[model samples]
Target: MKISELSRRTGVPVASIKYFLRQELLPAGRATAATLAEYGDEHVQRLRLIKALTALGGLSIAATRNVLAAIDQADSSEGALGAVSYALPVPVAAQSAAGDEEEAEADATAGAEVAELLAALDWQAPGTSPHVQGLTSALKELRRLDARYAPGELAAYARLAESVARLDLERAAGVDDPVALAERAVIVFAICAPVFELLRRLAQEDQVRRRAAGDGAEAASPR
Candidate 1:
């Protein structure tokens, strides 16, 4: 697609898109004979992802860039978050149920999700135990506040929590005793996901109200 179309689709202006390109937040669309090139689905996906992260995710451009860079770096690495994986027990029954008929319904999908996330991110699995627990606490609070979120969303959140926990374990890999090691993924998740989620839902609510207001104006105005 052309820059104009990309702009229309993302609801971002062509000028802003160019800015991102200049900032390297986005990859160069294409090199053209005339001096500029065309864009494709990858650019489109990235633009949308950027919008969700910035507009909804509330991350600054620099932070978003860092996160994206991390994911890309992790994707290129071997696994288990590099040296951190050794801290984890090579991935275990940490998954609640794996091979049962009852379990095949993607019951423990969070592990896979977080694993994929780690592969994509260049983030470190911080070993902050209190931070991990705080995240878990926030999720519990979220479920209490809003019941509309699907189970899958909750599971995805859980996977992240687990990943953080594993990350804590990774940081402790140098310690020989699994019998006593501190963990902190839940705390990190608390600090990260919930407040962002609150923003996304509030944005959704405001968008709905704006549409309703516009409809009311339409109904009330001279036609």
Candidate 2:
């Protein structure tokens, strides 16, 4: 396919496609002549991956380029199929439920919002996983309770999630086997979430109780 079709099919502009090629983000296609070349389905897939990285992965072009190169290089290697260079999962969202307009749009939009916010904040909190989606649902509940609230207000919770991410990475560092490390990381890390939330809630309740007791004692004292 020509560059024009590549742009049409990918929904990305032709100039942006050329810019990606020039930046070496996409590999050079077969050189048909001095000024033109043919792009194949592989090129289409690569371009899609590039856009996905930007749109879903929340990576800047420079970061996307580096990640693409790393991925491409890894693909060329004879390493075991399960081996990965980084701890991050591939940037991808799941297929949404069909035949439900509101449900689908809400999920898709929230996924995009979550991706951008997470990438911008450099948070790695399972952007498309069940946990993040549940978090998003919780956020919607928050919004319904107070329509004035915005999603940005909720991301402050990242301080805790990131604290967990740090702890998770440290725990994984002690394990050498990739499978065992991943298994423990996901399983144990997920269990920590509810416990951590409970601790925070309990601490807040204790503070509230203390303040209430102080107020009652003051009220009971002679004026």
Candidate 3:
């Protein structure tokens, strides 16, 4: 197949495909002549994957490159999983006023709470994990808002997260191909994240309605 055929089959524009080729996100097609190249099914698959990573997965080209590199170099499913996990963006903690004792105290408290939560759940994530850092920042903001959740409530949420993660991993299990596993991981992580958030928001609306009607669950009750 020619590049035009590859572009048509993938529904990616020729210019964008050329850009990807220049960026090395899509591997170069086999050179057949001075101004022409022959593409194969592999090129089609690669272009589709690139589109998914950039469009559906919401990854920047640089991040997409890293993810592709990770996929190319991955030796196992865990490696693929890690690649996708790291590619997803997390919230960054905003800087606080220097020498503010109250703000510093809140941060320390949030960090310790997160540490305890992780320990109690037996979830051994690195302190440097972006997810951990994001959670810590979230807890800090939550405390600042005076809407801090009880430890048991947080633990319950963590358990639910653990279960969700297990289910997410199970979706990709037994796939031996690195590219296939990476694609599944990207789809499950990137697409399902927004789905989960939207579902939670919808559930929150139902909870509000239920509480207004004096129905089930009774207004969250704050644990």
Best by TM-score: 3
**Models ranked on TM-score:** 3, 2, 1
Error of 3 at 162 (Å): 1.2
lDDT of 2 by residue, 142-197 (tens): 43345424656646666666777677567556655333433344334434445777
- How do the predictions measure up, each by TM-score? 0.40, 0.42, 0.89
lDDT of 3 by residue, 1-223 (tens): 9988988999999999999999999888899999999999888878877887888888999999999998899898898788888887776666555468887887799999999999999997999898888999889887777788975999999888898899888999898877777778778988887898898999899888988898766667654
Q: Model 1, clash count?
A: 17
The Cα local distance difference test for each model comes to 0.52, 0.60, 0.86
User: What's the lDDT for residue 124 in model 2?
Assistant: 51
Query: Which runs in model 2 stand beyond 4 Å of their true positions?
Result: 1-105, 124-128, 145-152, 214-223
Model 1 residue runs over 4 Å out of place are 76-126, 133-223
Which candidate, 1 or 3, would have the higher TM-score against the true structure?
A: 3
Error of 3 at 201 (Å): 2.2
